[model samples]
Target: MPRNRQILLDNRPHGEASTTNFRLIAEDTPPLRDGQVLVRHHFLSLDPYMRGRMNEGKSYAQPQPLGQVMIGGTVGEVVESRHPKYQPGDKVQGMGGWQEYSVVDAGQPGALRKVDTTHVPISHYLGAVGMPGVTAWYGLVKIIDPKPGQTVVVSAASGAVGSAVGVLAKARGARAVGVAGGPAKCRYVTDELGFDACVDYKQHRDATSLAGALKEACPGGVDGYFENVGGLVLDAVMLRANAFARIAMCGMIAGYEGHPIPMQHPQLILTNRMRVEGFIVSEHLEVWPDALKELGELVGSGKLRPRETIARGLESAPEAFLGMLRGRNFGKQLVQLV
Candidate 1:
């Protein structure tokens, strides 16, 4: 029997993630059953949502169980099969996770896809045409529902999800304003993505100044808010929403760590008749194919561009994931397995 390496959650962090929280160990491969197929991982996606799973608390899904493989989405190739549905060399995508191989059941729903790489980069299944891409499309179309000529504000503007929202909003003829952490991301959002304006959130220490900065950026007031960070940035945006504004509550990266005591701004919602709704990608899966077609065309035509910060090898997964938590990586963070 051959053995494969798997990464497990050794411990949970208080505020941020570290290499010590993860344990990489070798495990034996059990025999494939009647309906299982052996998968060789090609790419493993590291997303902000993984941070929430590391904690032992409530979220959209149950927190990852202790001593178990850290759950994630991956694009893989079929190496062996015990099921009729799959054959060797078939490329597939699923929740195979951070490991060299996995025994996936072919009968399992959404096991993977037998795809050709000629259309686009195979790794894109974990990125632009994959989960992150679909996540961005769903948040903007199904949630924000932007109107032409309206102002749409996106936090973490240069990231995978943020970039998707900005491009889609602009395509709809809405004015897009990006809110990012530094000057580099600000430039990428405005210059590359063609956003109407951008705000650097790192410069402002508190909500008061942040709100003032946003006011300067969107003088007409914000008609749609695609929120990523949830601490002071969210508090600041609350102050500037236009009447009947719609807020697409995506991931709350700011609140993923220790619970920070943020100022309450529910009154803004009440006074403006704002509709702020929270959503997860799974809830909108039915509309994903349509979103993918739209985004795929944009990518094909060179109108929608995606940025990625790649790390080589499976061993570097822990480091790459930690760097993302600390705001160390730019664009969509990914691990390329060799």
Candidate 2:
């Protein structure tokens, strides 16, 4: 039997998660069942949503119970297999979590995808080619629904989901405007990704003053908004949206630390007849093929680029996770375990 190192829930966070709220442990693996596969993690995807799971409160995904292995997305290689469908040495993507190894049932809902990394990095399967990619695709096409010549805006513009929205919007003939934290991210959004404009939110005197900068960036008024950080940022964008504007409400990284939700100008929504809708990409999985095909085509043609911040080793997951929440990462945050 082999020993697996895993991170487990120790305490529920009050607001932002802390290192003390988790525990590291070593466990001996049991004999593989007839229909199971032993997987050694190669990479772990650290995302903003994991912070919600650290709390005992309700959320889109179930909360991680005390003493259970912390939940997350994993890209792993099969070390042993009792299932006929999977063979040893094959790669997969699934919710194997923050651990060195995982014993997964072949028919489980979170099965890993077999990938070939000759053309691209395998970590992408957990990033732009996987869940984050899917999330960006669905959120933009389905939720925001930017039309040709429309002014499209994305918050957290340098991130996986936000950056994808900007690129896709531009490709679809919409004017893409990105809002990021600093000059570096702003330059990446406009110069690198070809956004029409980018507003450096970090340079604003305060979140309250972001609306002025955002208004200047979108003189035509925003038609489609791909939201990532909520609270003040959302309020700012909401104030600048044109009549009949559309908003795709994704993760609210800003408010994840339990900040008070800012009050919005509700009268503008009524007068402008704008629409704000929230969606989970998982709920729209059936529509992914079309979006994925388009995104893949863009990637293949070198139009869309995905940047990733890699943290080596599983033990680095904690710091990587914290860094994402703090906006210290340039792109999708991943912990490479292999």
State each model's CA lDDT, in order. Answer: 0.85, 0.84
TM-scores, all candidates, are 0.94, 0.95
Candidate 2 structure quality by residue, lDDT tens digits, 1-338: 58988988888888778888888999997899999999998888898988887877668878888998889888878999999989998888788989999998887654656766656567877767778888888888887788898899999999888888889888888999999988999989988889999998877765558999888888999998988898777888888989999888888887787776765776778888988888888788697678767766666676778888999977788888888999999988998887
What lDDT would candidate 1 get against the real structure?
0.85
Best by TM-score: 2
The weakest ten consecutive residues by lDDT in model 1 span 111-120
Q: Name every residue pair that clashes in candidate 2.
A: 93-112, 93-113
Clashing pairs in 1: 93-112
TM-score of 1: 0.94
* Candidate 1 structure quality by residue, lDDT tens digits, 285-321: 6987798788777776767777889998888999999
Name the TM-score of candidate 2: 0.95
CA deviation > 4 Å runs, candidate 1: none
Could you tell me the lDDT of residue 274 within candidate 2? 84
